[model samples]
Target: MECVWTRNGSRCGEAASRRCDRCRAVGYCSLSHQVSHRSIHKIECDRFRRQMNRADVLSDFPFTFYVEPSKVQVVSFEKRCSFLARHGVHGLGMWICECSCGSSLINFDTISFIPDWLLSSELCPCNEPSISLQGRLSSWKDYCEWRHLPLSSPAAVILHWPLTVYWAIQLATGCNLLPEIKNELRIHYLGPEKELLQLAAFGELQALFPGVRIYIDFVGPAIPDRRSDERIDLHSYALCNDTACRCKTEMVSKSQAVRMQLHAGFYHDRYGEFSK
Candidate 1:
């Protein structure tokens, strides 16, 4: 005669006379409790109805309620190629979904790339790639053009300086030069352009921190080492230049910001380096 449902951190153990109208198997002391439990009880009620309707006694197949599947269509292989061609994305060698907006490409591997609210809609108008595509494409194009230049070339230094400093920061302080500004912060390589790379990094840091005297180490190779009196790496606290690093390899192929955070933790504790 006691209510089967638990309520307010305790069992409803009161006398019960009302049974669930559908299953008639469970009872509740109050109508509120019954209503609150309906969402859960409906599942069991549906199962019970299914079991009752089955005519074959020997059939051991579990009862399953039929629900219509979503009608969203997956893009066909031919359509995918056409979409890629239209967008000028060639030879990526990966499966990508052209977001319904026709403005961005979404790699299938990034499962969480689509937000939950967007997932519920019939089509996802992913605007992130569209917004960032031009900037990234231009950056890559510039990188390719300057990539083969000698590190001492003024052109290479001017173009790839931001990226070089970004990596130096990562190696020295274990912190990424840029953090949390945008989604796509991949650093493109401009070869081994080391001329004035350290000076350029120091200048960038000084500009960012104004009045903070930063120092660069020229021993062996030119790299930003520390501020005049501070032992801490300047890159650790410097505002990320929003440029990508180039030294990153597939083994640690995470966003530059995330990878640097991991590196920072590793330097401090010596145990957090990413493992395969």
Candidate 2:
């Protein structure tokens, strides 16, 4: 038997004698090995807790609308009206949203106008605006503190914008709908907030597509920008020319040649920025 902690080429060939006290699903050769493996195990543990939490939260709610998951498709304004009418909730001041899981329908209050970005074809599974905002804000604050980055820094500036994370993932996967099933996806990030909103986005994607192999390339701090008032340049971070940075080269090597893919014909100027 061998130690079960497999991370970054770490493997304990020694005989396994101890099991995790919490899950009891893995064996470790020594107490030190079990302690060392806790970091990676925490991710899965947290995911399990979140699943339980979701179940608990939804336990008391009644299913107002029930549509077979297989029959659901992207709905338009007219289609939304039909859906509302079918559910006998038309003119009830409700907002409809599709979950990121590609199944289940969410109804929101119609008091506030939902932004196109939030209501677009691809939306978060959480569906609730307050939950989404709180999650993003908490992740942002935790990431900033963990990375020891100032709130006013360029990296912080980019990480604070959750939409940027969405754009980055879209650019990396070359898909308009995020959290899509994929064999593997690689992302190269250049900034201090390495585990900011991007981490949260990746977590969501992982939950949606459990088999996805996500590889992240952290390229340290962004290149300095002389033209901009800020010390760190946004453009340089968007498009790296340094030979050491493998973003461009990796994109070129891909079969799709995504480096040549332009977003709204402004890929070269301000590639990462999300436009209306």
The lDDT leader among the candidates is: 2
Task: Give the RMSD in angstroms, all C-alphas superposed, for model 2.
Answer: 20.6
Question: Residue pairs in steric clash, candidate 1?
Answer: 151-193, 177-240, 178-240, 187-244
What RMSD does each model have against the real structure? 24.2, 20.6
How does candidate 1 fare on TM-score? 0.18
Q: How well is each residue in 88-147 modelled by candidate 1, as lDDT tens digits?
A: 432221112222333254322222111111111112111111122222212322333223
Candidate 2 local lDDT, 1-276, one digit each (tens):
457555554456578999766555457898988888787666556544543444443332221122212122223223555654453433321122222221133221112221111211111221211121222222333333333433222222122333343334543344333465357655444342223212322223322223445443333222222211122111111222233433223221122111111121111123234221
Provide backbone clash counts, one per model: 4, 0
Local accuracy by lDDT, each model: 0.31, 0.34
TM-score of each: 0.18, 0.20
